[model samples]
Target: MPSSNDSRVERARIVASFGRQFYVRTLDAPGPDRVAVTRGKRTDFCVGDEVTIRLIGADQAVIERGLSRRSELIRSDRYNVKRLAANVDQAAIVIASDPRFSEELLLRMLLACATAEIPALILANKSDLATAWAAIAPRLQVYRDLGYPVIELAARDHPQETRAALSRYLTGHNTILLGESGMGKSTLVNTLVPGAALATREISAALCAGRHTTTFSKWFDLPSETAPSGAIVDSPGFQTFGLAHVSDSQRVHAMPEYTELIGGCRFHNCSHIQEPGCAIRAALESGAIDPIRYLLFSRLAGRD
Candidate 1:
């Protein structure tokens, strides 16, 4: 039996969210997660959010308010903003050689991560496909040269090697996994979190939405042997990653190659597209910056 006093408030971290329903694990005690919801139309909560909750019953609570977030990854279009996760230490952008992952989407995700002040790494999955790997290896090098760590692994073909290669990165940090469909993101999750499949099934059942695991975000704790203090949040796979929420200046500064050349531009408000003496364009012409990236930037900046 619980009391009717205000002493029922407890700190909790959101572990899963689907639609307006959220599942929060109490930080004050070790117990099963409680289904939580905001008072009114407050639906801003996302997986990995730490919030204060008031227990209304044995298996449910009401989210009182959210704590300050250290970092948040978001994607947006002209109409809506989609929050991916919060309080994550870093992000792992998984891509595969087969099915031809979109570099544009990858860039968008990197930009979002950069704007959110979250470090990102590229996981080049499907390394066992030698022919496809050969074709994309050079492109992967481009990202590596930009100072992002790129780890190659075949999630499906070599589970042990994949786990070993990613263990260091996953240790002691809360990582958010993002990737498009067919990139082995799910396979990697199962490899790192052995019980992830069963957990997903349980989450789906708890949410009363069968077969909706891939459409929602959920958190999984890493095994103690693998990562004592680490956890991973698996987000739904999507083809498009928008950045309409990011301002132009933020986007420009987010690019590693353009950071050093920013002040070199002639005009203080140079858009870097048609502006003469633009340091970015100059670098592009001088072979100092990758042409493909520059083209992508131009397109994103609406100059192409």
Candidate 2:
């Protein structure tokens, strides 16, 4: 403990972060940066986690310290607090034909990202069932209109099309792919991982839901050829996500489509609920917005 040398000290900046585990290289050089660091991290760390290192040798370093984040994405945990997924550039909400799209669940996810100002994308998968996509599109228009870049695809059918649509948001950014069971999130993960196979479940037409396969969130690196610079985390699909941490207004702000009507609302305190003279209400009454979505937003926004 009495080493009074620079050999005991090391410092570097975080460039690509995925929760507690992050990849860091040396500050001055390139070619994979000659190093990687991780130090018993249990919470969140992102691309910008400023860290002090414990020098092990010329060949290795350990993250002994971390700086706080400028912003973060988090969802409610059991103890009445939001758990963080630090350094995520965007949250990709995946939806498929069966286990049918839960707009309520979707809104909660969208609000979670919006609370932190993180961009959100809606990936509508399972295009082999074009009829299913058509049936679901009207329900999804809320999220689309709200400004999430909606991507339509089938997990197995068109690799080139899927790659082209998703490649842009994912470049050099750590994104989380999340949705309910049977939504082909695992299929998507399988696509991203080179020679790695993640199990996927099928849907029950009578019940209209997918059998659960994943029990907890796990990380996976995308194929270097497809996502060369950064990686993606395919989180365990959830039945519901808590939105108590973010307000209704903040949720609306996270939604891109609502950008125009946000400040246009008559009342600064508008909940878009029973408030009179509300622009959102006007849109709702005129069928400019989906009622199912409005209902979900009201219920979740009530948490504030």
Candidate 3:
């Protein structure tokens, strides 16, 4: 709650937002005591959004306007698109062993992050599961060779290591934590930020998927001493992440591995499916490009 004399407009960043209410950290006081604010009927806000708010009453305020957003990460399905986070500098894509792992989803997520122009770091959780780790190691290496950083972490077994590694990646950046349910995203969040006690649930044996634990996106500032200022936003787990907003051209350019060969394709507008003299296929056959990634690209381009 605000003091009786707190009626004024101020700049703030949205730390947590859901429905009509938002938890905003004031520019002057960036800490735990965020003012709870509501939006006007037409006002829209997302986690990491910078906005101006006017305090109208004690502990309450209304968002007056949203500042410009540098970038917006969105997930879409056939039905609709939803904004996951805004103004994030990097994306932390978390994958785990429980409930099984999907390479297709991983590729899609990386592509989405690439298209959004946000660098992504792959956090392979549950490395303590030896059998699962062994099976996923080769695929993980493919991503690593493509120049994306891959950090192996056993969140439960090595909390300190996980926190330290994550802190290094998040330093000086606003990173969004992305993953499917049951992948230990919440658990990682709890480890990274001790004070953030996000709820966690076990994977369902029958369904082979994790139950939804997070219902909304929330941001937490990281503890800083020698490192640059950093923060992370934990988003709710989802079964699917769509890239309907990304164009075919953007998708092709997003993959750094394919960049060198893109210009050599047969057609200037090569779909890369059945086109003759396609350089992408040539590279895949010659072992220059990873076959699995090519397949994933084909699927995304509707060529599969």
- Highest-scoring model, TM-score: 1
Per-residue error at 155 for model 2, in Å? 1.4
TM-score of each: 0.93, 0.71, 0.89
**Candidate 1 vs candidate 2: which has greater TM-score?**
1
- The sequence of per-residue lDDT tens digits that candidate 1 reaches over residues 121-216 is 999999889899899999999998999999999888788888788889999999999989778777888888988888788877766765633878
Error of 2 at 202 (Å): 24
Instruction: Candidate 2: list runs displaced more than 4 Å.
Output: 1-63, 82-84, 196-212, 215-224, 255-259, 262-267
Each candidate: what lDDT? Answer: 0.88, 0.65, 0.79
Winning model by lDDT: 1
Q: Candidate 2: TM-score? A: 0.71
Residue pairs with backbone atoms closer than 3 Å in model 2 (clashes): 99-209, 146-257, 147-257
207-278 per-residue lDDT for model 3 (tens digits): 243455777677877778413688888888787778888788888898889889889997998888888999
Report clash pairs, candidate 1. none
Better of 1 and 2 by lDDT: 1
Residue 255 Cα positional deviation in candidate 1, in Å, after optimal superposition: 0.6
Q: What is the lDDT of residue 148 in candidate 1?
A: 99
